[model samples]
Target: MISTQKSFEKKEQGSLYLVPTPIGNLDDMTFRAIQILKEVDYIASEDTRNTQKLLNHFDISTSQLSYHEHNTNERTPQLIEKMLNGQSVAQVSDAGMPSISDPGVELVKAAIESGITVVPLPGPNAALTALIASGLTPQPFYFYGFLPRKKKDLVASLVDLNKREETLVFYESPHRIKQVVEQMVIVFGAERQIVLAREVTKRFEEFVRGTAPDVLEWLENEQIRGEFVLIVEGNSDIEEEAPQSWESLSLKDHVEELMENQDLPSKKAIKEVAQLRGLQKREVYAAYHEINE
Candidate 1:
């Protein structure tokens, strides 16, 4: 199951390039990303109409095939077939990176399973961009893209996320911003630090930094618009405890144990072990997946 990719190496089959688009400011688009989109045989877009505006701006005439949440099941195989036939494809979301609170993960998995080279071209990402400027500890941060919409699920999730000792990052729409902040006040307390970054890299880009209560009060006075990135201070009062016997196990096994016992997904479970062992999340993730990188 160990697979390694020398991303740029020439191969018989074409590669699947995960190209990221600008989050807001069109000027933020990278030259390399643009070039890949132009060179690809086809561009699998989340929304062809929206992507057309971008294509027109950049003058990229690559043919596009609609690929979004609803059409993923059907479009995946067709796109995979193209790549298998030696036609390269660039997968792009409506905005930002593909698979970050958006479509493309399933396609990525399918490409990997099909032995197609998967190349990621990094660019604008709202979560990391917000975290660095949020005045919170950036390293060892947990990026939970978006929380569940259900009131019960959101509260339950926050209660579990509250125990971590690293900064938490979340994405929220304009409508849910106020509700999410109010719930944070109840679960994470009024004193916990919270930073709200919205309209990222746009003309109206802004960041609201204050305690949970402070942010909620501000929301009540203003009209919420644009997407929001919520950066929350982690639990600082976690008491240090003796290392358990489980710490002796391999990193992969440790993550699996946490997943089974705590009912955590691989991403959350990996974050837990990363915080406990003073390691980067990527390092733990690689170990768990047996990836050389």
Candidate 2:
């Protein structure tokens, strides 16, 4: 299971470089990212047209192929084959790092399985960029890239995250920004401090800092624009609780204990037990219902 990759060493297979693009400002693009894009035999881009603009701006003509979410399954094997055939590739998203709230994870995994070197060139990222300037504790921050769209799922996710002491970061579209903050006020309480960084690293870059309710009030009066990074202060007054260990319990007992302790339904408890034990949900479901049915 252990594998070592010498990124710069000469090898038979070509390297698959993970190149990061600027979130907004073009000047933020690193020199090595540009060089990799130009030198690579192919550039697998999330949006070929959007990446073409960046390439054109830099005056680098690299042949590109579409590699977005829609076409990930179809293109992953093809890209892997190219790298295995000794053709280097550079994977990039529309902005920021590839596979960060973007497509390219499957291709990267396939490339690694086929012994292709993946060299990641770091550059612009909206999460860390916003976190540093949000006037919140920057270290030990949790980056939860976009929240679930469904109201039920969103609240459930926030309910779990509200217990952490580290700062939380999230990405939200302009359309959902208002609704997300409204829910945050409910789950995280109106008094908790939060920062909204909109249009980060762009011409109209702005940060709105205050309690959750204050930011919600500001949003109600203003026209929200551009992408947003929501930075929330962690739960400082969270009560310390003993960790629940399932070592002594059987798999079925573990499921029952979760249902009884957490007040979760049988299905949800079984799923939780499966996740906690790293077993398949189907496996846990069967074990929890040995004689039934």
Supply candidate 2's per-residue lDDT for 143.
Answer: 90
Candidate 1 per-residue lDDT over residues 78-185, each given as its tens digit: 999999999999999999999999999999999999999999997999899889899999989999988999999999999999889999999999999999999999
User: Can you write out model 2's per-residue Cα lDDT over 1-293, one digit (the tens) per residue?
Assistant: 79998889999888899999999999999888888888999999999999999999999998999999998888999998888889999999999989999998898889888888999998899999999999999989999999999999999999999999999999999999999999999999978999999999999999999999999999999998999999999989898876678878998999899899999999999998889888989988988899553
Q: Where's the lowest-lDDT run of ten residues in candidate 2?
A: 284-293
Judge candidate 2 at residue 202 and give its lDDT. 97
Give the whole-model CA lDDT for all candidates, comma-separated.
Answer: 0.94, 0.93
Best by lDDT: 1
Candidate 1 regions exceeding 4 Å error are 239-293
> Which residue pairs come into collision in candidate 1?
none
Residue pairs that clash (backbone atoms under 3 angstroms), model 2: none
Task: Provide TM-scores for the models.
Answer: 0.81, 0.83
